[model samples]
Target: MSSRHSRRSHGHSSGRNSRRTTQNTAQLIESLNTHRVNTLTELCRIERVAATASDEDQLAFQGPMTSAWTYYVTSNNLLSELRGLTRNYPFSSDALDDAKWRVSNDPESNRSWNYAWLVLIKMRDDQMVEAYAASEAAKPEMWGGRVPEAEEARQLAECFAWEWNEALEQMLRHWDTPPTTTGY
Candidate 1:
Protein backbone atom coordinates (compact mmCIF):
# COMPACT_ATOMS: atom_id res chain seq x y z
CA MET A 1 0.00 0.00 0.00
CA SER A 2 1.24 3.42 -0.88
CA SER A 3 1.81 6.06 1.82
CA ARG A 4 -0.53 8.37 -0.04
CA HIS A 5 -3.39 5.88 0.31
CA SER A 6 -2.72 5.48 4.01
CA ARG A 7 -2.51 9.24 4.40
CA ARG A 8 -5.83 9.69 2.63
CA SER A 9 -7.71 7.72 5.29
CA HIS A 10 -6.53 10.08 8.04
CA GLY A 11 -7.65 13.66 8.09
CA HIS A 12 -4.82 16.16 7.76
CA SER A 13 -4.19 19.62 9.24
CA SER A 14 -4.36 20.62 12.89
CA GLY A 15 -6.63 23.60 12.07
CA ARG A 16 -4.56 25.93 14.22
CA ASN A 17 -3.16 27.99 11.38
CA SER A 18 -6.18 28.87 9.32
CA ARG A 19 -6.91 32.54 8.62
CA ARG A 20 -10.07 34.25 7.47
CA THR A 21 -10.20 35.68 3.99
CA THR A 22 -9.97 39.40 3.46
CA GLN A 23 -11.84 41.68 1.05
CA ASN A 24 -9.56 40.90 -1.87
CA THR A 25 -10.63 37.25 -1.88
CA ALA A 26 -14.17 38.47 -2.20
CA GLN A 27 -13.17 40.59 -5.20
CA LEU A 28 -11.34 37.79 -7.06
CA ILE A 29 -14.17 35.36 -6.49
CA GLU A 30 -16.44 38.00 -7.97
CA SER A 31 -14.25 38.40 -11.04
CA LEU A 32 -14.10 34.64 -11.62
CA ASN A 33 -17.86 34.26 -11.28
CA THR A 34 -18.48 37.25 -13.51
CA HIS A 35 -16.20 35.81 -16.16
CA ARG A 36 -18.00 32.47 -15.93
CA VAL A 37 -21.43 34.06 -16.23
CA ASN A 38 -20.48 36.23 -19.17
CA THR A 39 -19.10 33.28 -21.17
CA LEU A 40 -21.74 30.66 -20.35
CA THR A 41 -23.08 29.69 -23.73
CA GLU A 42 -23.18 26.00 -24.61
CA LEU A 43 -20.71 24.52 -27.03
CA CYS A 44 -21.98 21.67 -29.23
CA ARG A 45 -23.17 18.66 -27.28
CA ILE A 46 -20.69 15.89 -26.46
CA GLU A 47 -23.39 13.40 -27.69
CA ARG A 48 -21.93 10.49 -25.71
CA VAL A 49 -23.61 10.91 -22.31
CA ALA A 50 -25.54 14.08 -21.62
CA ALA A 51 -27.64 12.35 -18.95
CA THR A 52 -24.92 10.14 -17.50
CA ALA A 53 -22.35 12.97 -17.07
CA SER A 54 -21.79 16.59 -17.77
CA ASP A 55 -19.72 17.65 -20.75
CA GLU A 56 -17.78 19.48 -18.07
CA ASP A 57 -16.41 16.29 -16.42
CA GLN A 58 -16.04 15.03 -19.94
CA LEU A 59 -13.81 17.96 -20.82
CA ALA A 60 -10.22 16.89 -20.26
CA PHE A 61 -8.05 18.54 -17.61
CA GLN A 62 -5.33 19.67 -19.98
CA GLY A 63 -7.44 22.24 -21.83
CA PRO A 64 -8.65 24.15 -18.81
CA MET A 65 -5.36 23.63 -16.98
CA THR A 66 -3.49 25.20 -19.86
CA SER A 67 -5.81 28.15 -19.91
CA ALA A 68 -5.67 28.68 -16.16
CA TRP A 69 -1.89 28.21 -15.94
CA THR A 70 -1.40 30.67 -18.76
CA TYR A 71 -3.85 33.11 -17.22
CA TYR A 72 -1.86 33.45 -13.98
CA VAL A 73 1.51 33.25 -15.70
CA THR A 74 0.55 36.04 -18.07
CA SER A 75 -1.48 38.15 -15.69
CA ASN A 76 1.20 38.11 -13.04
CA ASN A 77 3.97 37.98 -15.69
CA LEU A 78 6.39 36.07 -13.45
CA LEU A 79 7.27 32.46 -12.73
CA SER A 80 7.09 33.26 -9.03
CA GLU A 81 3.42 34.10 -9.51
CA LEU A 82 2.76 30.36 -9.75
CA ARG A 83 1.99 30.17 -6.03
CA GLY A 84 0.71 32.28 -3.17
CA LEU A 85 2.75 32.41 0.03
CA THR A 86 1.19 29.25 1.48
CA ARG A 87 -0.18 27.17 -1.41
CA ASN A 88 0.61 24.78 -4.25
CA TYR A 89 2.41 26.00 -7.32
CA PRO A 90 0.34 26.59 -10.43
CA PHE A 91 3.08 25.19 -12.64
CA SER A 92 2.96 21.70 -11.18
CA SER A 93 1.13 19.45 -13.62
CA ASP A 94 1.12 16.55 -11.17
CA ALA A 95 -0.58 18.61 -8.48
CA LEU A 96 -3.17 19.81 -10.95
CA ASP A 97 -3.90 16.25 -12.05
CA ASP A 98 -4.22 15.11 -8.45
CA ALA A 99 -6.77 17.85 -7.87
CA LYS A 100 -8.78 16.79 -10.90
CA TRP A 101 -8.65 13.19 -9.74
CA ARG A 102 -9.94 14.06 -6.29
CA VAL A 103 -12.90 16.01 -7.61
CA SER A 104 -13.81 13.52 -10.33
CA ASN A 105 -13.78 10.68 -7.81
CA ASP A 106 -15.94 12.61 -5.38
CA PRO A 107 -19.17 10.63 -4.96
CA GLU A 108 -21.38 13.69 -4.55
CA SER A 109 -20.10 15.56 -7.57
CA ASN A 110 -22.70 16.73 -10.09
CA ARG A 111 -25.55 15.76 -7.75
CA SER A 112 -27.00 19.29 -7.63
CA TRP A 113 -26.58 20.50 -11.18
CA ASN A 114 -28.60 19.53 -14.24
CA TYR A 115 -27.07 21.64 -16.98
CA ALA A 116 -23.43 21.66 -18.10
CA TRP A 117 -23.36 25.40 -17.63
CA LEU A 118 -24.22 25.25 -13.94
CA VAL A 119 -22.04 22.20 -13.32
CA LEU A 120 -18.89 23.77 -14.71
CA ILE A 121 -19.32 26.99 -12.79
CA LYS A 122 -20.09 25.18 -9.55
CA MET A 123 -17.10 22.82 -9.83
CA ARG A 124 -14.61 25.59 -10.48
CA ASP A 125 -15.99 27.58 -7.59
CA ASP A 126 -15.70 24.55 -5.33
CA GLN A 127 -12.04 24.15 -6.28
CA MET A 128 -11.30 27.75 -5.44
CA VAL A 129 -12.86 27.25 -2.05
CA GLU A 130 -10.83 24.14 -1.38
CA ALA A 131 -7.56 25.75 -2.37
CA TYR A 132 -8.27 28.66 -0.08
CA ALA A 133 -9.03 26.31 2.77
CA ALA A 134 -5.88 24.26 2.34
CA SER A 135 -3.69 27.31 1.96
CA GLU A 136 -5.09 28.84 5.09
CA ALA A 137 -4.50 25.69 7.13
CA ALA A 138 -0.76 25.74 6.62
CA LYS A 139 1.55 28.13 8.42
CA PRO A 140 4.23 28.47 5.80
CA GLU A 141 7.81 28.91 6.94
CA MET A 142 8.26 31.86 4.60
CA TRP A 143 5.44 33.77 6.28
CA GLY A 144 7.47 34.17 9.53
CA GLY A 145 4.21 34.29 11.51
CA ARG A 146 1.39 35.99 9.58
CA VAL A 147 0.75 36.41 5.91
CA PRO A 148 0.58 40.05 4.92
CA GLU A 149 -2.60 41.72 3.70
CA ALA A 150 -1.12 42.17 0.27
CA GLU A 151 -3.02 41.20 -2.88
CA GLU A 152 -1.07 37.95 -3.36
CA ALA A 153 -1.43 36.98 0.26
CA ARG A 154 -5.12 37.76 0.37
CA GLN A 155 -5.74 35.29 -2.45
CA LEU A 156 -5.12 32.37 -0.08
CA ALA A 157 -7.38 32.33 2.97
CA GLU A 158 -8.88 29.79 5.29
CA CYS A 159 -12.22 30.40 3.67
CA PHE A 160 -13.69 32.97 1.40
CA ALA A 161 -17.18 34.17 2.23
CA TRP A 162 -18.24 34.34 -1.36
CA GLU A 163 -20.77 37.03 -2.15
CA TRP A 164 -23.24 34.54 -3.48
CA ASN A 165 -25.89 37.20 -3.00
CA GLU A 166 -24.44 39.26 -5.84
CA ALA A 167 -23.75 36.16 -7.91
CA LEU A 168 -27.30 34.95 -7.42
CA GLU A 169 -28.52 38.32 -8.62
CA GLN A 170 -26.43 37.95 -11.78
CA MET A 171 -27.58 34.36 -12.24
CA LEU A 172 -31.19 35.38 -11.77
CA ARG A 173 -30.78 37.96 -14.49
CA HIS A 174 -29.30 35.31 -16.78
CA TRP A 175 -32.26 33.05 -16.11
CA ASP A 176 -34.59 35.94 -16.85
CA THR A 177 -33.55 35.90 -20.49
CA PRO A 178 -36.22 34.46 -22.84
CA PRO A 179 -35.86 30.78 -23.60
CA THR A 180 -34.26 30.05 -26.94
CA THR A 181 -35.75 26.63 -27.68
CA THR A 182 -39.42 25.71 -28.07
CA GLY A 183 -39.28 22.04 -27.05
CA TYR A 184 -39.81 20.60 -23.61
Candidate 2:
Protein backbone atom coordinates (compact mmCIF):
# COMPACT_ATOMS: atom_id res chain seq x y z
CA MET A 1 0.00 0.00 0.00
CA SER A 2 1.06 3.61 -0.62
CA SER A 3 2.37 5.66 2.35
CA ARG A 4 -0.54 8.13 1.87
CA HIS A 5 -3.15 5.34 2.03
CA SER A 6 -1.48 3.76 5.11
CA ARG A 7 -1.42 7.15 6.88
CA ARG A 8 -5.17 7.67 6.32
CA SER A 9 -5.95 4.11 7.54
CA HIS A 10 -3.87 4.61 10.71
CA GLY A 11 -5.53 7.93 11.40
CA HIS A 12 -9.02 6.44 11.02
CA SER A 13 -8.20 3.51 13.37
CA SER A 14 -6.71 5.84 15.97
CA GLY A 15 -9.84 8.01 15.85
CA ARG A 16 -12.05 4.98 16.44
CA ASN A 17 -9.82 3.79 19.31
CA SER A 18 -9.96 7.21 20.95
CA ARG A 19 -13.74 7.31 20.73
CA ARG A 20 -13.97 3.80 22.18
CA THR A 21 -11.74 4.74 25.10
CA THR A 22 -13.91 7.80 25.80
CA GLN A 23 -17.07 5.70 25.71
CA ASN A 24 -15.59 3.12 28.12
CA THR A 25 -14.55 5.85 30.54
CA ALA A 26 -18.06 7.35 30.48
CA GLN A 27 -19.55 3.91 31.14
CA LEU A 28 -17.18 3.38 34.08
CA ILE A 29 -18.18 6.71 35.63
CA GLU A 30 -21.86 5.88 35.20
CA SER A 31 -21.36 2.47 36.80
CA LEU A 32 -19.54 4.03 39.76
CA ASN A 33 -22.41 6.47 40.28
CA THR A 34 -24.98 3.70 40.16
CA HIS A 35 -23.03 1.57 42.63
CA ARG A 36 -22.65 4.47 45.03
CA VAL A 37 -26.38 5.20 45.03
CA ASN A 38 -27.31 1.54 45.48
CA THR A 39 -24.80 1.00 48.28
CA LEU A 40 -25.96 4.09 50.17
CA THR A 41 -29.60 3.06 49.85
CA GLU A 42 -28.82 -0.41 51.18
CA LEU A 43 -26.82 1.04 54.08
CA CYS A 44 -29.70 3.29 55.08
CA ARG A 45 -32.10 0.37 55.00
CA ILE A 46 -29.74 -1.71 57.14
CA GLU A 47 -29.41 1.08 59.69
CA ARG A 48 -33.18 1.48 59.91
CA VAL A 49 -33.67 -2.24 60.37
CA ALA A 50 -30.98 -2.41 63.04
CA ALA A 51 -32.45 0.55 64.94
CA THR A 52 -35.88 -1.07 65.10
CA ALA A 53 -34.71 -4.59 65.91
CA SER A 54 -35.20 -5.87 69.43
CA ASP A 55 -32.51 -7.79 71.31
CA GLU A 56 -34.89 -10.69 71.89
CA ASP A 57 -35.99 -10.67 68.28
CA GLN A 58 -33.00 -12.48 66.84
CA LEU A 59 -34.95 -13.21 63.66
CA ALA A 60 -35.43 -9.51 63.02
CA PHE A 61 -31.70 -8.92 63.53
CA GLN A 62 -30.67 -11.58 60.99
CA GLY A 63 -31.79 -9.76 57.86
CA PRO A 64 -30.17 -6.46 58.71
CA MET A 65 -26.97 -8.13 59.95
CA THR A 66 -26.71 -10.14 56.75
CA SER A 67 -27.41 -7.06 54.66
CA ALA A 68 -24.78 -5.11 56.57
CA TRP A 69 -22.21 -7.83 55.92
CA THR A 70 -23.07 -7.86 52.23
CA TYR A 71 -22.85 -4.09 52.06
CA TYR A 72 -19.43 -4.18 53.73
CA VAL A 73 -18.11 -6.63 51.14
CA THR A 74 -19.73 -4.87 48.17
CA SER A 75 -18.70 -1.38 49.28
CA ASN A 76 -15.07 -2.52 49.65
CA ASN A 77 -15.11 -3.76 46.05
CA LEU A 78 -16.72 -0.54 44.83
CA LEU A 79 -14.21 1.59 46.72
CA SER A 80 -11.34 -0.31 45.12
CA GLU A 81 -12.86 0.25 41.69
CA LEU A 82 -13.45 3.92 42.41
CA ARG A 83 -9.82 4.38 43.49
CA GLY A 84 -8.60 2.81 40.24
CA LEU A 85 -11.10 4.78 38.13
CA THR A 86 -10.23 8.07 39.83
CA ARG A 87 -6.55 7.47 39.11
CA ASN A 88 -7.30 7.20 35.39
CA TYR A 89 -10.08 9.80 35.15
CA PRO A 90 -10.65 13.16 36.80
CA PHE A 91 -13.42 12.02 39.14
CA SER A 92 -15.05 14.81 41.16
CA SER A 93 -13.78 15.47 44.68
CA ASP A 94 -17.37 15.31 45.96
CA ALA A 95 -17.79 11.77 44.65
CA LEU A 96 -14.64 10.62 46.41
CA ASP A 97 -15.69 12.36 49.63
CA ASP A 98 -19.13 10.76 49.51
CA ALA A 99 -17.61 7.31 49.11
CA LYS A 100 -15.30 7.86 52.07
CA TRP A 101 -18.18 9.22 54.15
CA ARG A 102 -20.33 6.20 53.49
CA VAL A 103 -17.61 3.84 54.72
CA SER A 104 -16.87 5.91 57.82
CA ASN A 105 -20.54 6.29 58.77
CA ASP A 106 -21.59 2.69 58.21
CA PRO A 107 -23.61 1.43 61.20
CA GLU A 108 -21.93 -1.97 61.22
CA SER A 109 -18.41 -0.69 60.61
CA ASN A 110 -16.97 -2.44 63.69
CA ARG A 111 -18.21 -5.91 62.86
CA SER A 112 -15.64 -7.77 64.94
CA TRP A 113 -16.35 -5.67 68.03
CA ASN A 114 -20.07 -6.16 67.54
CA TYR A 115 -19.67 -9.92 67.20
CA ALA A 116 -17.60 -10.04 70.38
CA TRP A 117 -20.25 -8.10 72.26
CA LEU A 118 -22.96 -10.41 70.96
CA VAL A 119 -20.99 -13.43 72.07
CA LEU A 120 -20.43 -11.97 75.54
CA ILE A 121 -24.10 -11.15 75.87
CA LYS A 122 -25.10 -14.61 74.82
CA MET A 123 -22.68 -16.17 77.28
CA ARG A 124 -23.87 -13.94 80.09
CA ASP A 125 -27.47 -14.81 79.39
CA ASP A 126 -26.76 -18.57 79.29
CA GLN A 127 -27.80 -18.65 75.62
CA MET A 128 -24.31 -19.22 74.23
CA VAL A 129 -24.42 -23.02 74.15
CA GLU A 130 -27.61 -23.14 72.14
CA ALA A 131 -26.58 -20.30 69.87
CA TYR A 132 -23.12 -21.75 69.32
CA ALA A 133 -24.45 -25.18 68.45
CA ALA A 134 -26.97 -23.74 66.00
CA SER A 135 -24.31 -21.57 64.38
CA GLU A 136 -21.41 -24.03 64.49
CA ALA A 137 -22.07 -25.95 61.28
CA ALA A 138 -22.10 -22.83 59.17
CA LYS A 139 -19.32 -20.94 60.95
CA PRO A 140 -16.41 -19.74 58.84
CA GLU A 141 -12.92 -20.69 60.00
CA MET A 142 -11.91 -17.13 60.89
CA TRP A 143 -15.19 -16.15 62.59
CA GLY A 144 -14.72 -15.09 66.23
CA GLY A 145 -17.03 -16.60 68.85
CA ARG A 146 -16.86 -19.10 71.67
CA VAL A 147 -19.14 -20.30 74.46
CA PRO A 148 -16.66 -19.45 77.17
CA GLU A 149 -17.24 -19.65 80.90
CA ALA A 150 -17.20 -16.35 82.82
CA GLU A 151 -13.67 -16.93 84.10
CA GLU A 152 -12.49 -17.87 80.64
CA ALA A 153 -13.95 -14.70 79.18
CA ARG A 154 -12.20 -12.66 81.87
CA GLN A 155 -8.88 -14.31 81.13
CA LEU A 156 -9.31 -13.77 77.38
CA ALA A 157 -10.04 -10.06 77.88
CA GLU A 158 -7.00 -9.70 80.14
CA CYS A 159 -4.79 -11.45 77.65
CA PHE A 160 -6.04 -9.21 74.88
CA ALA A 161 -5.34 -6.11 76.97
CA TRP A 162 -1.80 -7.28 77.75
CA GLU A 163 -1.09 -8.09 74.10
CA TRP A 164 -2.43 -4.69 73.02
CA ASN A 165 -0.18 -2.95 75.55
CA GLU A 166 2.82 -4.90 74.34
CA ALA A 167 2.06 -3.95 70.73
CA LEU A 168 1.79 -0.27 71.68
CA GLU A 169 5.12 -0.48 73.51
CA GLN A 170 6.74 -1.98 70.44
CA MET A 171 5.25 0.75 68.25
CA LEU A 172 6.60 3.40 70.64
CA ARG A 173 10.07 1.94 70.42
CA HIS A 174 9.92 2.02 66.63
CA TRP A 175 8.68 5.65 66.72
CA ASP A 176 11.74 6.65 68.78
CA THR A 177 14.15 5.27 66.19
CA PRO A 178 15.78 7.82 63.87
CA PRO A 179 15.40 7.49 60.12
CA THR A 180 18.28 5.71 58.34
CA THR A 181 19.55 6.96 54.98
CA THR A 182 21.14 3.59 54.17
CA GLY A 183 19.07 1.00 52.24
CA TYR A 184 19.01 -1.14 55.44
Best by lDDT: 2
TM-score of 2: 0.27
Estimate TM-scores for all models: 0.23, 0.27
lDDT (C-alpha, whole model) for all candidates: 0.34, 0.39
Q: Write the per-residue lDDT of candidate 2 for residues 1-184, one digit (tens) a residue.
A: 6999999999999999868755644443344344442343343343343344445433444444444434444456433433333343222233333434444565543443222122222232432323322333233331355455555555444443343334323322321221111110
Find the 10 residues in a row with the least total lDDT in model 2.
Answer: 175-184
* lDDT by residue for model 1 (52-129), tens: 233443244223322432343234322232233214423333333344455457665444222322322333455544
- Stretches off by above 4 angstroms in model 2 are 36-147, 150-184
Backbone clashes counted, model 2: 0
